[model samples]
Target: MILVTGATGHLGAATIHFLLKKMPASQVAALVRDADKAAALTERGVTIRVGHYDDTASLDRAMQGVEKVLLIAGTDEENRVQQHKNVVDAAKKAGVPFIAYTSRTLKDRSTMANLLMEGHFQTEDYIIASGLTYALFRNVLYMDVIPQFVGASVFETGIHLPAGEGKVPFALRDEMGEAMANVLAADSSGSAIYNFTGSEGYSFADVAAVLTDLSGKRVKYTPAEPSVFETQLAGRGVPDVIVQRVIRFLTDIKNGQEDDVYPDLENLLGRKPASLREGLKGLYNLG
Candidate 1:
């Protein structure tokens, strides 16, 4: 059976959604901390296994009789490395022959340094040293976050961020999940690295143009001072923690830290993922 961790989250849920298209739900399992949160998945015939990254016993229980595992990265940044190690360790102890991890995009850390990705790097290193066959998916920023980055009233308020001219290969989360499921279901013993990204890269200026075309409303792109942007988010009552995280991404973009473009996403999907114009239509609720 294939056990997908973090199964209730969007990415994990999407993976399960696509995996069920390829295989019976009897062969699928979900590792979740709360089974109640996974009622929908359970109702769909997916076996729900209660587990968390921090609890090795629970992880061991979740890994029982599982042949393969998709270890979705945890959100607890401060302790993620150790938590990831625990998952790997449990998978190893359970005699699971193969494992896959959801890692993030890596570039020379000139901006944000390793603050945002240290956990993933460390986890990758640990997984490689383990005896399991692995696939490390170095995923880029999700296109789903574009609406949040530009704000909800973007057509009226325009696009304001500290991203400057830096571009991101923002692939859709659902598409990435689909590609990952294809990988998991196709192979059981090989090892590989996949840099999941969109078909093309786009800067905020490009984003503004796409919005204009999709909505037929003139939207402007403005590079704001980082401090000013922080103040604006705060004034709008964004919590301090979330505000800081948002600023980190904007700063990373402003410094050209997330501008890498790659073809792995398209090659894996066997088709061009959605373009900026197409993705925005769905995001903006434009029929």
Candidate 2:
């Protein structure tokens, strides 16, 4: 059976949805923290196993009889490294032959450092050292967050962010899910890595233009200083850590870390991924 961790999450659930279309649900198992949340998946014939990254024994139990594992990166920035390490060690103990990890885009962070990227790099290193056959999927920022990044009422307030001319090659969450499913179904020999990114890149300014045309309202991209941006985010009730992370995201983009455009995502999906405007419309209901 193929075991996918974080099965209740947006990406994992979407991946399982596509995986079922290509293969039998009986061939798939989900490692989820909440059995209640996995009811839909279980009804579709998936074997739902309760597991948490903090619990190694539970992960071991979830890995039983599973040949392949998709270790979806955890979201807890503070504890993600150890959590990922737990999964890697459990997979090793379970003797799973192949493990696919969702990682971030490969880049040198000697200048602008990213805490998320740092965790991903550490997890990649651990997986490599574990000696399991693996596929490293280095994914870019999801276009699903475009609406949130720009803000909910962007058409009215315009776009405010610290990101300068930084461009991001954003892909749809479901499309990325499809790509991951395809990888899990394919051969897993001689470990490989794939960069799943959009065909085109877009900056905040481009997003503003798209919003203006789509909504028939005047929308503009208003750049803000890092301190001002963080203050505004915190004032809006965003957590201190999250606000700092958002600043780091914008800073990374400004440093040209997320600007690389690649065709691998389309190659994996056998079609072009959705554009930023298209993705935004779907997420924001821009009708």
> Candidate 1, residues 29-132: lDDT per residue as tens digits?
99999999999999999999997999999999999999999999999998999999999999999999899999988675444633767678889989999979
TM-score of each: 0.95, 0.96
Q: Residue by residue across 68-179, what tens digits does model 2's lDDT show?
A: 9999999998899999999988988999898999998846656554666788888999999889999898989888888778877887899888998888898998999999
**C-alpha lDDT (0 to 100) for residue 166 of candidate 1:** 88
The segments of candidate 2 whose C-alpha lies over 4 angstroms from its true place after superposition are none
Number of backbone-clashing residue pairs for each candidate, in the order shown: 0, 0
Q: Which residue runs of candidate 1 sit more than 4 Å off their true CA positions?
A: 110-114
List of clashing residue pairs for candidate 2: none
On the 0 to 100 scale, the lDDT of residue 69 in model 1 is 95
> How accurate locally, in lDDT, is each candidate?
0.89, 0.88
